[model samples]
Target chain A: MFEKLARMDRRIIYAVVFLSLSIPLIWPIGLGVTVGPETKELYNTVESLAPGSAVILSMDTSPGGYGELASGAAALLNHLSRQGIRVIGMGFFDTGPSLLETAFGGSDFKNKQYGTDYVNLGYLAGSETAIARMAKDIPGSFPRDYRGNLTPELPAMEGISSAQDVALVITISSGTPGVPEWIRQVGDPMGVPIATAIVAVNVPNMTPYMQSGQLSGMIPSMKGAAGYESLMGTSGLGIRGMDAQSISHLTILALVLLGNVVYLGTKSGASRGGGR
Target chain B: MRRELPVALAFAVGVLMIVSFFFTSEPLVEAAKTVQNWGVIIAAFALGLASVNLIQIHARRIIRGKGLDWLYSGALIFSMIGIALLGIVRGPTHRTYQFWFDALFVPGQATVYAMTGFFIASAAYRAFRVRNLDAAILLLSAAVLMLGNVPIGEKIWSQFPVIGDWLMNIPNLAGQRGMLIGAGIGGIASGLRVLLGIEKSYLGGSSS
Candidate 1:
């Protein structure tokens, strides 16, 4: 039994994980969710933004990272719309603008006027340097909006000369030229507040920034998305996806535990057949 | 002359950028801005250069490769050119361009990323053994974090979330902050090396 268990086919693991994920997704368990302090702070920060205030929403993620971050971005954008804060959207990643378009369409921004309440300033080519330039001169960085409209002509961009004109900067991020770039370029130097909707892998690395208050707040991974969703009194992908996320976590834990148990059993046996 | 000119240019540009960042001198700031704009234009050209490089490498594969290697390369070349043309003619915001992006590219990349979850699970199970005291601690911490981040963990034990937060905020932040500070200092040291022309690795050779 130990030998067979030790050499189990990898396909079994795949099948089990697929089922564990799919079942919860199909019929969500609706487990009770407790909002963390960081998530609540992000909610409160957005809530505190006054009407007509402009915020920079940079979609600095690729399609892969976008898949994970889209839920939180939608929820945050929805909240931003509700508070009547104008959003000036742009992307450091080339895929950012298209994802921004998707985000706006899926959120309440679609109901808001394009040039007034929100606008997509499209993508800039340079990575960190572009962000620095944008911080120094927002209009110069993007003269034309994603749809080819003049940026200065847009109502949402009025008086938005530099990063200082915006109330806050939020990045839905995955890779390089992301949160750290924003911090060095715009946040710390310009005294502009920065926040993020980041993937799970990066959450640990970003905690120090959060602790130092360099990041005003963050929506971390899908759980953070769910917390933000609950705070908003709305249901979307974040809330629904939590069930699958929880199950998958538990499944991985179980696999680790089971493997340890097998290891112990094999080690304790009378004579190991030349060991594992 | 070949190497000296490039190194001198690098030193001058580097010093100029550092000076402009710290001071409010108008001419220095303007020069830095122009240099940054040049960086942006170069980055845009780099994208085009990358596409050409991809085509060159894949075209070779299609010509000389056997079996399905050519097929895969052909598909890659086709998609790259097709998408570039579509975006060029109709703009990236056009529905047809977005359609191919959303229908094919997004899902393809997303699927590749999602598959890592399964791989991680299998790999962790096989490899995460308590071989020593450090390994035991690592495994224990991983277990705690995994359970704490999920709702089901709270259902099992209410204190799991609290412990998780404490673990992350205290130890994780402390370690992360140290690494960040160390990295920041290291970056400055390296920048100084390159600016002073003591590091000539960028010129494809060791420091002289």
Candidate 2:
């Protein structure tokens, strides 16, 4: 039985992972995540905004990571929308446009009218270069909307030229041409207050901007997303994923300890045997 | 000329973009906007072109029969051309195109996303071999996080939440912050090098 356990088929592992993930999702552990200082800072930055404050949201992740980030992004949008702030939603990547539509179009914020309450400038290409330009003259870079409507003609573009017109820029990015580019291009020079939410792998890259005050605040991956969601008094995918993430982290930690114990014990036994 | 001109052009564009970042003057900004708009159009075209390119390459490989599986290649090419023709010839609004996209594209992308399960499991298995003090800490932290995340563990043991929160907020944030600083510096340095023409990785392969 022990030998069989040692050489267990990968299907067993797959089943374990699937069951482990699905069970928590079905019956949430209701694990409370403490909203960290950074999350609070992010919340406050958006919260402090006066009504009619021009805000830009850059959704720069594909649909896959979108599922991971959807809750935080939706909650943030809801918070801003409640404030009656003017929103200009856009994406730096192609697939990002659809995800933003889903985030905003969801039940929580469905009544928000397109082009009046908010506008989607759609996916702009050329990666970081487009971001740099959009920071200056938005219409200059985005002459038209995704549907080919004249962008300058839209009410959302009223008095909005350059990053300065934006009171705050919240970019939820999964990777490159994201937070750092915003800091370098818009926040640093244009003085637009920048905030960002990014994947766990990217949190390290985003920290300096937050530290430097280039970014007003940040939501760091699913944990950060969960923390932000908790503060909003709404639990979503981010909060739910926490149990699975926590368990996975702990499982990895336990395996590491076991491996070390075996290694040390073997080493000691080998040393004593050599001495004999 | 073929390689060097494109590389040099990329270098020049990179500089212009960097300057456009700080300057924002009319000419610089206009040039930047023009370049960006052109890029958007080019990228849209590239997406379509890439699919066509993929079909051609696979079709050629199949014909040559040079260490390649012809039957599989044929199927792939047929799908590519099929989709392209459906969109271009029959129009994107046609039922055929919509059906192909919904049936093939949507599910394929979803399956790809779901495949991350295999990756995470492999990574976790490798990472969880506790060897020493740090390893023990990591192993323990991982277990706590997993238990806190999964329902059964929390159902059995209520204290999982507190420990999970601590693991994420303190150690996780610290590790993430360290990485962010390193990445920021790397990004800035890389962006500068590109602007200065010192890096030509974007110009494809070897600088020489």
- Using DockQ as the measure, the top candidate is 1
Name the fnat for model 1: 0.71
Q: Put down candidate 2 lDDT per residue, A164-223, tens digits, no spaces.
A: 988999998887778878877788777889888877666655654666677788887777
Model 2 misplaced regions, further than 4 Å: A244-276, B1-25, B31-49, B61-111, B132-208
Q: Please give, for residues A170-211, the per-residue lDDT of candidate 1 as tens digits.
A: 999998889999999889888999989999999999999998
- Tell me the docking grade of candidate 1: high
Per-model C-alpha lDDT, please? 0.91, 0.73
Clashing pairs in 1: none
True contacts kept of each: 0.71, 0.29
Evaluated on CA atoms against the true complex, candidate 2 attains a DockQ of 0.30
In the order shown, the candidates' DockQ scores are: 0.80, 0.30
Error of 1 at B44 (Å): 1.0
